[model samples]
Target: MVLLLDGDDWLYLHPAMSAFDSAVARGEMPPVTLVFLPARDREAEFACRSELWEAVRDELLPLVAESGVTADPGRLVVAGQSLGGLSALYAALEFPELVSRVACQSGAFWWTPDAPDRPDPLGGPVGGSLAARLRERHGLTGLRVAFDVGEHETRMLPHCALTETLAERAGATVRVSRSASHHDRAGWRHALLRDVAWALA
Candidate 1:
């Protein structure tokens, strides 16, 4: 089953609904079980901490388990765009064996107060170190990663780059697109469909 995670705003459908429906028409839309978490701003206060991720892992796995979509945790995949993309990568890092694939699109990799090379601008070591630490510490032996960002989305490049770096270092198979800029439903649908097709293929 697929999970269509919302972005930081948690209010929009991801890009590729039309493609998804078309896939459904062709019997290709993977069976999906959606779980919409709250907005990133709402969750950021606690996201750096382990509790939030732990809570999601605790809750979502059981639902999938009950549904029989993935009896083995290792077969599950997590995917999202923007903040949701960041969260998907973070979740897979946090729980390696449980998530086999992580599809990130225009991910908010720069959400931290400071970058890996910068000191904590937010006043704590943890603020700038989460992504780096995830890369350095996580075991992603079988993880498959995918990402897409628009060429015109200048503000998002650094974050997306950082995520790509980490995914590559973790031994993930990564993909990127520079044609699709950061956008609403209309903008992301094509990329999402492509990503989902690749992930499930």
Candidate 2:
């Protein structure tokens, strides 16, 4: 299944899924099985929260499989934008066997555990908590990950660049690209579909 963790407004805006379907209709790509797992609380559900992951592993996946979606547990792809993007990568790192592929767009790599309370949150760290976790030497040989950031997002460049490099170093088949717009989904539309296709490839 393909999971989409995005802005509530875009919950109905299945640009990537729609594009995938169009591609399939045109014989460009094969049929895909997709599932949308919207985040209840963006910060709470998508962060590196151990409690949240445990609940996801213990309660969510099993329910999703039986939810009549025709999803394959072994062929999972998690896609998210912005903060959701961070969570997608976090899941790939923490639950490697479960998430075989990841599509992250404009991830908030500036996030730090203490930075939220600090005077300068964005300036406090690069790659934040996820970067620290990536340093743990988690082998991602079986994982395929795609990272795309907005070229106009100057503030997010360094952090995202570092993250892309680190994921590749961790042995994931990584694909990196830049979108034309800023952090908005308008800029992420193409990357979203392209990256997901790459991940599934």
Per-model TM-score versus the true fold:
0.73, 0.89
Compare the candidates by TM-score and give the number of the best one.
Answer: 2
- Model 2 segments more than 4 A misplaced: 13-17
Steric clash pairs (candidate 2):
none
Give candidate 1's whole-model lDDT.
Answer: 0.61
RMSD of 1: 4.6
Alpha-carbon deviation at 190 in model 2, angstroms: 1.3
RMSD of each: 4.6, 2.1
lDDT of 2 at 114: 77
The lDDT of each candidate is 0.61, 0.77
Q: Top lDDT: which candidate number?
A: 2
Model 1 alpha-carbon drift over 4 Å, by segment: 7-19, 27-32, 35-49, 67-71, 113-131, 134-139
